[model samples]
Target chain A: MYPKKFENLIECLRKLPGVGLKSAERYAFDMLEYSEEDINDFIQSLEDLKTSIHHCERCGNLSEDNLCEICKDNRRNKNIICVVQHPKDVIAMEKTNEYHGVYHVLNGVISTSKGIMPDDINLMTLLDRINDETQEIIIATNPTVEGETTALYISKLLENREVAVTRLAHGLPMGGHLDYADELTIIKAMEGRIKIK
Target chain B: MYPKKFENLIECLRKLPGVGLKSAERYAFDMLEYSEEDINDFIQSLEDLKTSIHHCERCGNLSEDNLCEICKDNRRNKNIICVVQHPKDVIAMEKTNEYHGVYHVLNGVISTSKGIMPDDINLMTLLDRINDETQEIIIATNPTVEGETTALYISKLLENREVAVTRLAHGLPMGGHLDYADELTIIKAMEGRIKIK
Candidate 1:
């Protein structure tokens, strides 16, 4: 058995997503054995993360201030907006280094089972941002049922206006075998095929 | 890519065992999302672990002060000392609720491959603790080759002393099948079998 103070450490570690009792115990021992300077650095970093990071007012991405770096960059195409489900999805798309447009994080996709709707997300703000100058609205949502439903709802809402809507092309993974491909994926790949030049 | 301030949080999370790039990224995000009050509690608990936990002066086990509860208990037998390689091992043996004597932690085991010798361990303090009143010394090292070598070396060093030296019994685990056993495990089990009365 550990001391009462160690119990507190275990309890705090258990709050982590995947950490359980044994993992919490191992983490407590690791922390107990670490040098004072290293422990202080860990704790200080956690505090800094809590205090310094905030959401970007324009794009809903995480940043240090109201405006994220992408929103503040004048060189970027403000007329093209890439709609994503979460801030992490924006980062994942950014890693590809292909898209030169701005981003709009919806924070979550529409889920009827969870009682989430288009109004519950940042859809109104996105509509307000749309103008005659806006050329494209890329629906970069995930390839899930909820993502497809959300994309359809957004597309229908923008149909009354003059903005062009597009979705990411779906296909098998780069290294995946066609023999193991699922029916839905093959159907999507066929439906999203491009025309020859 | 992340900001310089966020880099520290990522680095700290990466240092943890089994936490790779993706896991570190998730942990950093979780920390960034944690509330200020939760961050304060985490920092306070870390500081408490550093300032409050101390090694037991007699056995080197973790304690709130110089003496652990087991070492300070007047009813426990002081003549027999169980020597372990680390404080976690002490907790494991204690969980069995079988041993009721004091303990001596070597802090680490002797490993020539790692440039560690007998002198590098806390063996000298253990020798100093032995007296005429001492009866037995249990060597509860792990079953690794390094652990066996350390146990053998300690047994040889104490051969001339009056105290009786012993080791934990080893064999196949309960309900284990022989066909699934490894060669080293079979050898250990064969070497440790007892004769019937």
Candidate 2:
């Protein structure tokens, strides 16, 4: 409905994840409200993101260099790795501040419905890392059926290997209200309950 | 936290309307997934939005040139002008394709809480245009207290003018369920109901 330049921008923005036509236009038009200096800075930020970043060669996580900050850090638990489905999960886990271990991003879970296979993910590096002998491998994929299937597959592959395999404990989240928890969640919480010594 | 470049991009994205830290990170990471050429093209789109567009001299609508497309197009009804709060509203009205008239963007509504006054809006050129003798002025501000206040203020200002002052008729929106319509909206609908001859 707008000019070619404006419409082209909307189309380009729609290419971004989760952004629909209305949202793309909103983003474009909202950016127009920003000052020239701010807009230039934003453009510079985008350029930097594009030019200076890549997947970490070691862990399949995002990085500016060959190794991500977590993999490069000597202080972090180098022997322990938490396997997640995406980089966003890495960010989410990092926010907890409870886990100081490194991460291995599988990129995506095995989903036949989505046409995603084991080969399509960053599983090769994970298998190679496991063969090299890690202290522990924590599977922290989402609690979905696909996540469970992927976790089970990876655990089975690492069964013969000399590595401790663990899954994120299935329970109600720490801050979650008990009253709001569904029957399945309640059951999982009850089944996963641990004795405090 | 991620690399400096990635974090910077997320921060910049967070400046957009309705985008939170999580969504901003998602946008940055998704953009990272795009090829270099595609990312560069997106950067160009943003640059075009920033550099090429400005308010129309005549109606305060968005334009690459001095006058917006609507103002430049002589085929549009110059005699009837619809007053709106922003360029977004202009697009919304345009989508309906019901109004052949031009528009005058207030740029902002008068909000005491936000410290926005009538002086802050694009009123000077509106007065100049009105003095040039438009046949009608349609106030299409959002149906809020601020909108009604602005509409009434503008109507009072144009009391002595020859132009017919009109407000967008307030009523239950077309296809709206009566069960969901608020009491105020129902009252407005009743008050504004037309006799079916």
Interface RMSD of each: 1.9, 1.8
lDDT of 1 by residue, B1-197 (tens): 45556778878877766777767777777766577787788887888888988778888877887898888989889998988887777776666555688889887889989999999887778898899999888776666777778878888888888988877546545444332344555456434533211
Instruction: Give a tens-digit lDDT track for model 2, residues A80-148.
Output: 888888887777677655678888998778998999988999987887776554788877777677887
Give the alpha carbon lDDT tens digit for every residue of A66-181 in model 1: 78888888989999998887766666666655668898888778999899989888676789778899988887676677887888888888888788787756674554433244
Enumerate residue pairs that collide in model 1: none
**Can you tell me the DockQ of model 1?**
0.44
Model 2 per-residue lDDT tens digits across residues B1-197: 78888888888889878999868877887887788888788788778877777788899987888888999888899998988888777776676556788999988888888898889999767888875558888877766778768878888888788888777665746533332445566446434533211
Lowest-scoring 10 consecutive residues by lDDT in candidate 1 chain B?
B188-197
Instruction: Give the TM-score, chain B only, in order for the candidates.
Output: 0.83, 0.83
Candidate with top lDDT is: 2
Error of 2 at A147 (Å): 1.7
In terms of lDDT, model 1 sits at 0.74
What are the lDDT figures for the candidates, one per model? 0.74, 0.76
Show model 2 residue runs off by greater than 4 Å: A95-100, A131-133, A172-197, B95-98, B170-197
* Candidate 2: Cα lDDT at B167: 76
Candidate 1: which docking quality band?
Answer: acceptable
